[model samples]
Target chain A: MNPLDKPYAQLALAVLAVLVLPLFLKSGILATEILIFAMVVAACNLLLGYTGLLSFGQGIFFGIGTYAAGICLTRWQIPVPVVLASAAVLGAATATLVGWLSIRRQGVYFVMLTLAFSQLFYFVAYTFSGVTGGDNGLLGVPRPSVGGTALNAPWSYYTYVAVCFVAVFAILVMVTQSTFGRTLLAIRENEGRAAAIGFPTKLFKLEAFAISGAVTAFGGALHAMLIGVAPLSNIEYHTSELILIMTIIGGSSSLFGSVLGAGFYLLLADALSTVWPRWLLLLGLVLVTVALFLQRGLWGLVERGYDLVFRRERAPETPAEEH
Target chain B: MTDIALQTRGLGVKYGNFHALAEVDLQIRRNSVHSIIGPNGACKTTLFHALTGRVRASSGRIELDGRDITDTSDDDRVRLGIARSFQVTSLFPNLALRENLRLAAQGRTPWQALAPWRRAEANAEALAIADEVIERLALAPVSNRLAGELSHGQQRRLEVGMAMAARPRVILLDEPTSGMGIDDIEAMKQLIRDLGRDHTVLFIEHNMGIVMNISDMVTVMRLGRKLVEGPPAQVRDDPEVQRAYLGNMITGDIA
Candidate 1:
């Protein structure tokens, strides 16, 4: 099934409207959290599923983004827009440099280099005692404010985060639907074939990775603005793992699946950890079950189910018969 | 009358200690069906690779039309109207047959060096070319079939369709009818003959009957060097050709 053909634009607007309704319900805090996490997972999806290159270091960009904003707000007294934009650009440039080196290898080597780079970023952020506050992290990251209005209330802050998610998501979708998107899809199908047929497969992969890194950092910056904190925990490999699992459980190939997975998995983990405190075992168990049974994740599974239920609904006709 | 499509001067290629294509020189005429015929490992494929810029020559210059492109990459050669079909089926298995053809056609549209594909009138024209190829190749019925799902002969046809969709002036085919059945072989022969009207075709074929019946000229290679070149009838009757093919049976009227 052509997953990209799904009505993402219309559905994105619909989801945005539904999320805004939470502002009225006063559940905007949870809704904003869901939207932010969705964008992070969606950023990871840009490289992982679309370009077919998996990195274990996506959290570096996310953490860096958050820290960029967090440090700027607390120390530099930078505005939220500049902070977010600068963080994203910085992350993108960092990603480009990493890509220039890491892209020379493929498969396990690619994973290893990205992981190494992520760890390097983590240590840099961790050891900076004066600026990053070291283990304590920077505090008093002022709430993100627009031109005149300070988004101090949960409802107002959530609205801002929600709007950011919608815009980033729409752009990502445009990228996926454009000529760049089709070329990446070709690269994903078979890198060697794509190269043989005049496509610069390696260059495409690197550019895509850089784009993913930048987007992830943007999401991270926004998250820092929302929570008013940027701690060492945000950039760890475990954070990267969490986003990967979110992509897996919600259907990695589908953009919406990433969001759904982020919501379901994170919200579930958040609740379970508060109650049981050792929900890692349960989380691991759930991941194992999903991998074993429903490999495509919930959305893909639902999509397959839809196809099966509607068998009479215009089967894709084979052109071979016409020949 | 002195039109030259290709000219190779001392074209030599070495793989480690082995000389795959020794110092060889040849001129292929423009608008002619030139066939390269030889036994296994006679450097026929190597010559084709050299022509298409897939392999580097050890120390030689290769001129296409009138320009030197010895150091040009395969992709650049493709843009310069030298398109090729691999000896084996090279169509993308994941994509539909038409999509594969579309990709081939889309390569014709030039764009900024690092930019992704641009939507030129070329894209629509590419689709139109794909439709024409599908119809001409008798692939219209199987045009929507996944390339992997096609029968071996159909896949071979699709491979040719992919190369043809480029609208190249020069088409390099390596055994286009290698594994086809008699009926499919005939169809392929007919298609190649039809292509000869508009393209400068250079193919490698072991099937002597197909070569003599279709090729205007034949270049025979042996032991990594060009042994002879002439009209098919003349080359077929050469004593050296008979000795090369039949070993010691160069007897009587056969030679």
Candidate 2:
């Protein structure tokens, strides 16, 4: 059965879960972090999982959105929705430029090209400390007000981020279930065969890159408003590495996997850092185990478990999520 | 001869200092199964590559039904009613057999591919074509199975089925019966013979028995040059073909 049969109902339940999550934790901070980063991981999933293009420069697009939102809100006094829209546009434009130059190459070269382009973005932002505030970051970016009321409370901001998160998530799920997405899967399987069948694979890859960049930037914009700073750390290589790790951990090509991955990594890091100074060592070991044992990531494990318990004949991998 | 479906004039390919194919001229008549048989180094595959625009000819003019398409891209060649199967089986292994054929069929009509809603509307034309091909190739039982999981013979049939999915005026088959047993070879030979009734079929084959049996016309190549071209019987009787194939070592069994 097609798993995407009732996306609206699934989304409503998801939103409901987020609404009650803060009650159990007593702090909405981690929940908010999960929501924002889930969007980022989903964007990464678009390129890496679906299109089969591993871009290490996704952080640059997110950083661009964060910086753009910060500049608009702090200096120009732009409203919330407009700033977010501008950030998305800026991210898409950068991704288009980078994708055009990088898509010509494949495999390791593709990864290196994106990495180099991101470094270029990082240095550019670093050099313009006057505008970017460099190491100090663009601090005190305001949480948006909805129709004259400031979203100062944690729950209020969580509601705002959750709404944005759900909308983008639904859009992504639709895309993955689309014909264009199938073509991307075809390209991922055999690019030569895809082209021989009359698909312009490069053009498809570019479209994927643009869409992924826009969503990631939108997530970054929301993140900046939530944390009250457009920090340099958002653009750094380390952030890119973390996002890539989350994508793999959740499972490549699975959208729900993206959310599961981002939340798992973020929560683990948050909880572990309090107990140990070198918490990453444990995280690294966990990642190794996941990579070695569960190549499909946590999502594949979930599917395997579902198959075993239900005793349903395992079918070919479909784009839709089970949950 | 009937009207020329495909013609190449002085087609040549150079790799640095070596000549992969040189000074080759040929004609593939409409609605005829033409087999290009040669040794491994005779550049039969290179000639196919040039025809499909997989590799640019260093010097040549390729005409498809009276229009020059020497500079066309591979995918454009497919659009212009030309399709080819690889020497090695090329398929989307993870996808179902039906989906592989559907992908090929859908390539002809790409307008609906971007519209996700339209994609689910059941592309009747593509589905019909895929269904017909699956039945014709006897892949009905395994239609839902992944292409990679199929037996080698089934995979070979699917590869050719994918080429036919394009509804090409001219279909290129590179060793369709390679590595098949006697039974599979006979089946493939019958399929090619049937295919010749409607489509301009061109193939490269190492097996002289199948080529000599099924092909209406044959071209023999030696070291990137056309050594002989004529009817299957006429080419089979040529002394040059015998000497070229290690003095009757290649053609002795078939003739």
Candidate 3:
């Protein structure tokens, strides 16, 4: 069976992640950030890990989703649910267009295409000072409410995010482990072979990118709703790279790794910001060190350990010299 | 008389000044094991690629089941009941053997694209199909084993099995017996012989003994052109084949 057959388990984990993390986190704000960022990592993993396409424009969609929601409640007076939905659709639509163009090329060209398009979004945002507020960004974005009940408390908002994460995580897990996922894996293993097998290889990859973009955007929109504004700095190429680093460094094997990576990275960054105050330098140092030392990342190492233990257990049980 | 399965007319493929395949003409029949043999750079793989839609033929049209398929992509070819196995083993190395065969059997479709969602039923079917294929290939023990961990010969059989799962009307095997030792070659030859039941097979083999024993017809090539085509017995007796291979054998250590 596709590993994602257990949608309930994955959903439970997503919920458990949000609910349980508060035990360790000193502040409700920190807990919410950690959960949302974990979502960002999982979305990145869908592209980089399973599909074998490393996209660098995820933040563009994330930031765009944030801006869409921000602009909706503040400028257009749209309902919070309507704003979130519109933002998600916008993020997915933009990603589809970018992915359609980007998936055509292979190797370095794919990476360059995503990076170039992401920068294009940044420039567009920077140039359109009217709607986007240029660098200043929109303020007083509305909070999600159900029947005049404001979901404004940290736990309330965190629960909302938790529910959304659970759904997205379940959907992504299904996408990753399904027959469609197998096609993506085939593409990753060998693009030429996958094409020869009669796959519309590029299109499948593009769809993955689009979905991945949508998820990232969902997280970003939620983050903006929680924080009150969407800044251009939040969706730049650097932000995309940070998500990539988190996914790869934490492990791209399972969606579980994604959550772990996001939490650890955010925690590290939070610790650095408190002490030295120059957080970016601390993050850069950590990313470089992890990249240099652990090419497989943290989850990769854990998987290796798991495999070693299992192999040892199975070794003596073989009935005969197996073929 | 057997009808033509694949026919190419006035086909020319060139990379720069070099003619990889130069205006070659050939007719391959249905239900026959048609083997292409030649010296290095004889354009066997290039021809296979063009036939299976890997490389675009600079000039000429390809016909499948007497229908034009010149512009069809490889996946479309598979849907049209044409399939191919690579010279090298290609599969999801992490997944079990059954999953690989299931994907092949499923082919590539929108339903299959949504496969990850239908986990319970799709996976069970994939596993069942994998087990059937494994049992058919006498690889039942390796049903749960990782594809990357399988032996070279097992991998070869699995590759062929993957193609078989596509349920192709015609199967193309590129150098199926390329790197096998003597024993492995014989096993591979039997595997191919068993596979001859359902579909027409087109393959290339460097080792003449295996080619002579298995192929119903032979297409000989030299320097990007079809040197000759005939029954194995007649092609074996041809003076041109003797001269081409003999010339290389005496001059080249392979003789």
Candidate 4:
């Protein structure tokens, strides 16, 4: 069967996979880590794949979310739900500022603008040691409590994180299936025609950026809760590059590919680091192979395999290289 | 005898030291087929851009039904009942034919974005319009095909269908039949005739046969200025039109 022809069936399969993953994994913590990054990768897919924009500054919003959650828990002693909501708002606000200024240009100029702004935010976080904790980073963040009991146990926290992941994923799925989402796809395919047909494309693009930033930031907040520490590295350019690589390796436009990509990248890194000090060299080689041979990433390979097994006529490959 | 559908006075556009269009005065009447004809580099496309607000006019006033709309933005111009098709067949190439038509039909209602669950009536309206355009353009057989995968003639027809899907009162089509087979040209001419029954059609055409057969009024441009404007028969016999298009096939049938 053609997987793209049956989106609902594909979605059900993905949900089932996510539900049963924690039962088979050796460490729930690693699974939780993969889930969190999967949310960020899904956010990237909305902008990069559906909207045809390549933003290199997603880490800034992610960092802001982490810092917001850490400060609220440590300084004010606020409840966990409130902290997450506030972090999301902060991320959306930051995205509005950056997207408004950066979207004035197109192509490589737009990429450079996002990179420059992200670097600027990184230095600001680095310089303000008293507020952000500088190189030491913020420490001693609290685990959330429901009613009177704290979810201090690993599996208990994993369940809570998993719930958050499912909620975010559901919302993103709804968004991508809506009329607004179709408009974004139209813009991605042809901006000039979208405008000629009476769409305020610039406004649509900005709102998309804001939504992407907010979701990624929410994922970052959940991550801080899982680790109890908001490190300086989370905001660095390396994290931004890592997130981009994961999104591409999974598949650009497919939401399910986000989870698969994050799991593949993180699990491979964790497994290889134990044996080899230069593990990234191997990852780099794999990435090159995927880029050249499988333009749609790992998901594209899976679809091809499905077609090979079940059908004789192959579907035309999606033109993912244009972006 | 018909009210003026669109009028431009002293319309001019310049690029640094070069003048692309200079002091053009044009008027298109309601419910008529008007075609602009000129040799290459005569600024027919540039004038179209100024009319659609795609390019800023150095000096001009564009009036749509007696309203000054030179200051209107591109998208706002579309919303105000003016739609355009590009010369290069601009379309959502990766999307299906129906999806492209639907996007053009629903571009004005951005408020639908506020909620996930769309209004049934709005979606129904867009779909109905898209379906109608598809049947009219005879694209039902390949409605599920990606626009990029279609042949040049089919893509050109889809481009026109996209503009019509928006339900505009006036259409500015840039070379709608630029590169089409003879059968496609006849089909396009019939479609334009049908559209002229209710809406104003302002098109740029190089085909002398189609222009002479279909246009109610014709404007010929040369060197960024209007050479002549009259009925097609009057224009084909104008002495100045012959002088401007000398050694060009556009004037070959003038005598």
User: Candidate order by DockQ, highest to lowest?
Assistant: 4, 3, 2, 1
**TM-score pick, better of 2 and 3:** 2
Query: Scoring each candidate complex against the real one, what DockQ results?
Result: 0.34, 0.42, 0.50, 0.51
Residue-wise C-alpha lDDT for candidate 2, range B195-246, written one tens digit per residue: 8987999999988888888888999888999989998888878887776573
- For B1-255, candidate 1 gives per-residue lDDT tens digits of 348887889999988989999878878778788888878889888888788766888878988888899998776777778877878777778778888887777666533223433432336777898889988998877777788889998988988887798888788888999898889998988888888889988888877767888888988888898888898779878888886564533222312
Pairs of residues at least 3 apart in sequence or in different chains that clash in candidate 3: A178-B116, A179-B115, A179-B116, A198-B75, B249-B255
Model 4, B9-77: lDDT tens digits are 999999899999998999999989999988889999999888888888899899998989989988888
- Alpha carbon deviation, residue A134, candidate 4 (Å): 1.2
| Cα lDDT of model 3 by residue, A144-258, tens digit | 8867898888877877877787777878878776678777777787777666666777778877877887888888898888887878777788889888888987877677778
Judge candidate 3 at residue A183 and give its lDDT. 74
Query: In DockQ terms, which candidate is top?
Result: 4
Candidate 2 C-alpha lDDT tens digits along A1-323 = 22422455435545665666686665676788888888899889989998898999889988998999889999989989999998999898889899999998999999999999989989998999999999989999999998899897888898898889888888887777777777788889999998887776787888888888999899889989988999998888877888899999999947877888988898899889999999999999999999899998987886777667765776755532211
| Candidate closest to the true structure, highest TM-score | 4
Candidate 1 CAPRI-style tier = acceptable
- Once fitted onto the true fold, the runs of candidate 2 whose alpha carbons sit more than 4 angstroms away are A1-20, A312-323, B111-122, B249-255
What's model 4's lDDT at A115?
95
Quality of candidate 2's docking, in CAPRI categories? acceptable
TM-score, each model?
Answer: 0.87, 0.93, 0.92, 0.95
Score chain A of each prediction against the true chain A by TM-score and list the results: 0.92, 0.92, 0.91, 0.94
The alpha-carbon lDDT assigned to residue A222 of candidate 4 equals: 84
